[model samples]
Target: MKWGRKSMLVAAAAAMLATAACGSKAGDSGAPANEAGGAAKPGNAILATLGEGNDNLQGKKIALIMQFNEGAFSAQYVAGVKEQVESLGGTLQVQAAGNNLADMASKLDAAVNGGFDGILTDHGTAEALEAGVKKAVDKGIPVVAFDANLNVPGVTVLQQSDEEMSKQLLEKMKEDIGGKGNIVKVWVAGFAPMERRQISYKAFMDANPDIKEIAHFGTADKPALDTQNQMEAILKQYPNEGDISAVWASWDEFAKGATRAIQQAGRNEIKVYGIDMSDEDLQLIQDENSPWVASIAVDPKDIGRVQTRYLYQKLHGDQTDEKVVLEAVMVTRDALPKDKKINTTELGEYIEGWGKSEQGIADWMGRSDK
Candidate 1:
């Protein structure tokens, strides 16, 4: 994943078109923005689209505006978006909001007015995105939103089953801790998925009166590093065995941070459970004496691909659902492969119900876009 000089040049060239692409800082949204997952070259080199009716995506200019662009999950999701768009003969560029809500809102406005044929929005609040989404609808543009809390008509809202993800993670944590213990919660509010996941978190806290929350903390910016720093301090404060039972992370980044902090302190008694998983996460889970024990997540890449497919379907005048929720999967340390390292693609073999879904697939999509 090291970016050499050549890769940087390629990424810069690929992102040039997206300078004014989707989100706020990337263009004239009043702040400076950069492209997400711009470490690789774009796939506009060899573009082709084939199908019978309403399947033509070639030459379709697409924009992906993102408010959060960090971690392996986000990288894979961006990869999926880029790959799907390229496969279907469309061009895509990513615009980053740098975790700023106002910048994200401004990016939405830029995408609406930025001449993008289709738009893909990632992680913004309802208050900031509704008016801009409504504008896109008025202009007859198709939009596929990922974890953005917008109720605008004609905008396809896509996300993982947030409640289900939380439910599964919490259920496992409760079972592991015997339903009663002191635990820390790592989460941030305002993002659509985080908000929905909080629903179950709240319910879990209420339902389990014995499971007291010893500490609660999280942040959107540099989440893993920040969480590690904070967790280290928290560990010192509660410097005794059984003082903390487990750490429940709303996102994998937080889990990773807390895991490192816990492991470095040699707190083998403490465990970590989280939402979302990646190759790095899996590796950490399998690491000797690692504190990260379990996580629940949908395929991040599949989310992006499905989001792109929905956008293509909408642009083709096909009727689609207003809400699309991807299925979630739980991965525990016990379920991990013992002999080998498995990336996301090979995860389904070990974990049940962990593969791609046919949510936005259509007959017109065909086998190949060539």
Candidate 2:
């Protein structure tokens, strides 16, 4: 169960074949314009173009079971899936397990027995949902997972390259802090992606012995509030400008909290780095006094659309990769709007790949071949 960097590389190289193209995303008019009179390309819009054969999806019943529905990321992901499913004339049954494995198990069972054509498990784990996934697969229901490593056969696992992402963020932190400093780590175990990222994190920490980890903590549920409280306590405990040189958060929510705490403590010297990007996360980075430096960006909406499209392909007898590992990029304060407020949709414009990865996948599937 130990996911090594070598395995991560192989999976990533294979998955890269699905997202190599770069161009205007699906719904964009591809016209040239500028921000001069506000007629520029709108970044905050649904980016995936629906496939032509939605008629095939008409009347098909699909189910999306989520492990938790706590943030804008989850909302956007479901919105992307709903857009695709409804456009294709299908009805999607949405259910949230609210971080309860038993609830996830029950939902999976219900979806299978209720005769759903396809099932999508979002942000779950194999230890919790494997049996349900296996039963659904055995019943011939096409199942695709987004960020869930459910080790069940015949299930397509879709996720971003977490290990590589962690490495990128940590490397950035190393550069920013001059390779050696007292750092705090925010993490929570039992999640698959977090576990993989932990491997990458440990490797980085071990490789750099001078970087002392002063404390470790994380938050869930009300992540923004809880993380802020935890970090504020950490700051109070350390209580010095350079005592805490940097903080490496496993995810953006934790980073946001840490950054807020640092800002409040007036410890601008402490830089915060993390994985995952959101509009709010970028807003923090855009703040002139913010301690957040950078993070790995993965558009949840794009991920939802891509996984759904891949599921569509699987249903239509198209052979797809067993695992679809997404490509992600680093987004810094430099890439965000300087003086104005921006949502995730608008924020995505600054990321290199943005909506293009799913478009590439759809293009490769010949969804636009007509």
Candidate 3:
């Protein structure tokens, strides 16, 4: 919960299993390069790589139940999943659980009993949805979790490499600030990814004594606005340049808020380092006078595509790994084009290892018409 103060040592140690993965995300290369995180579809071209389509996925029903649909990340992720399902001729129903834990649990239970052929969930805790997920598995329904912590048998869990992302971001933050200074942290605990990320933050803090944390505040509610309000208050408290060296935002919403606050306060002297990505986040980072420098994240759309593909694989009676982890890329302003705006689909050209993944590509799940 309180990840910043005294209880960070154990979390630091747990976060030490650093990821050693990098390459092109092959699965997302199926479609034509699309711009922006929104309105892009990773087409059927990837079907060329798979062996055959069972044709069983067509006409099947899918239920995508989410805990929240906030920001460009969630929207683009949902868009990817929807388009993937449609390309396979499957019907998808998305349920938004908002901010209520009970609502999240009930959505899973409803998906199970609602006669859907397969289910995909985004961002719910094992405590709230484990029983329902277990029940779904027992009922012979295929379930895939994106950024959720449930580890039920017969279910697949997919997540970005959080440890590596954090490691990448913080190392850069340290370098940007000359390896020592005060910073403010924005993050929340409870969600799986956030918890994983905190591990690296704690470890980084422990390793670098010169890097001092001056303030910390975060929330899942109206994350960007809340962070802006809090960060604005912190700016006023410190007011002078160099009083805060940088802000470490574990999520993009926090980064957006912090960057806005610092810019409004005319504090470009401070840098903002964060995790997660989106088109809007790109624009912010690319701003002429923006303080948001870098972000480490996987393409959110690819996350959805991978999750849905795994679900379809299960439907085709193919075996898939219980855990699917995608590689991450550090998108820096220097790496992006000065003249053109790009989306996750086109990021590979500018940022290395952007959309590369091999998780759900199956020999039995490509298009038969081809």
Candidate 4:
């Protein structure tokens, strides 16, 4: 993690307060420490002091810009951000780029011009946002990026540990397939997180020569339906137990399609391992007949809360790691809730630690202050 404390204006604008932000507290006998002074805490604990007593975040305007506004993941992520920002007494300014690169850039420019105190970019690539992010920084407006593969000098990049997630998913696939069989892969090129995961995929395949790729499927267009149709065709062509060992998908959407195809075709022998998850994913995995056995599930809401907290810290003059990669939890079919009453919005409630972050406490305390 690299830390680049920029202009004086940025430092002046920085602020922080947290009850349970991210990771454990630092500076105790048992807590770890480095030459720099404190060991980083996991989950939402901030061990180091970021210097308190700044103005509360109330009435501060924060802009959250995204490339797309659709999908379950997007909805949950937006919900998380809305909850955090509102709790922290900051007003949220939302912009949807509609998957247009130029529009994304324009929205960033708008946020800066509109004088938002902070900016958050979701799932954007460097090509689509570098200039705009640079502009925001130039204006002394701190910007935070979520899932954007950017190497910008001062922006904070928050993402999941994709390589480790990929490794776990692939290891599970290898176990199910006995380390050797015909496998299908669903992937896309150019997306940053997928690119990192692809590196792991390649390394895994190289180390295990026994696993052979019988077919290559890409999910660039009409993701779920396209993948489902393709998997159905493949299942028809190879209609034998153990003939197709497993299907590996880079994301849960592709995995959902593969699972559907397998279930429809009564291919009970095949299993799927995928990265990422949503409420729909949990529902499917809970099904006894689902081919999607496991996934590297992450709480999108938690991601939003964490990213928002990072912005809150930065706004309060708190020092943070340049890059924060959150670890993922392995979710399996058997571990899913037996009752199907839970709705998508309530999914986070079922998660181990969702809205109960130290950041939430900070927000409430700051608001209640006289």
Best by TM-score: 3
Local lDDT at 37 for model 2: 11
Better of 3 and 4 by lDDT: 3
User: Each candidate's lDDT (Cα)?
Assistant: 0.74, 0.67, 0.74, 0.66
Weakest 10 consecutive residues, lDDT, candidate 4? 15-24
Clash pairs for candidate 1: 23-107, 24-107, 25-33
lDDT of 1: 0.74
- In model 3, how large is the Cα lDDT of residue 150? 72
| Best prediction by lDDT | 3
TM-score of each: 0.85, 0.82, 0.87, 0.79
In model 1, the Cα lDDT at residue 147 comes to 81
Each model's total of backbone clashes? 3, 0, 5, 19
TM-score for predicted model 3 compared with the true structure: 0.87
Per residue, candidate 3 scores C-alpha lDDT tens digits across 1-370 of 2234321432332222111111121112112212212455563223212334455456888888776666777767766776667667776677766555677788789889989899998777787778999888899999998877777888899988898889889999998899999999987666688778889999999999999999887666566877788889889999888899999998888899899999998999999998888778888988869999999988776677789889988888878888999888899998888888776667777887665554576766554211
Per residue, candidate 1 scores C-alpha lDDT tens digits across 176-253 of 999999998887654567667879999989999999998877665456877798889889999999999999988888
TM-score for candidate 2, residues paired by index:
0.82
lDDT of 4 at 97: 55
Rank the models by lDDT, top first: 3, 1, 2, 4
Clashing pairs for model 2 are none
Off by over 4 Å in 1: 1-35, 38-50, 53-55, 368-370
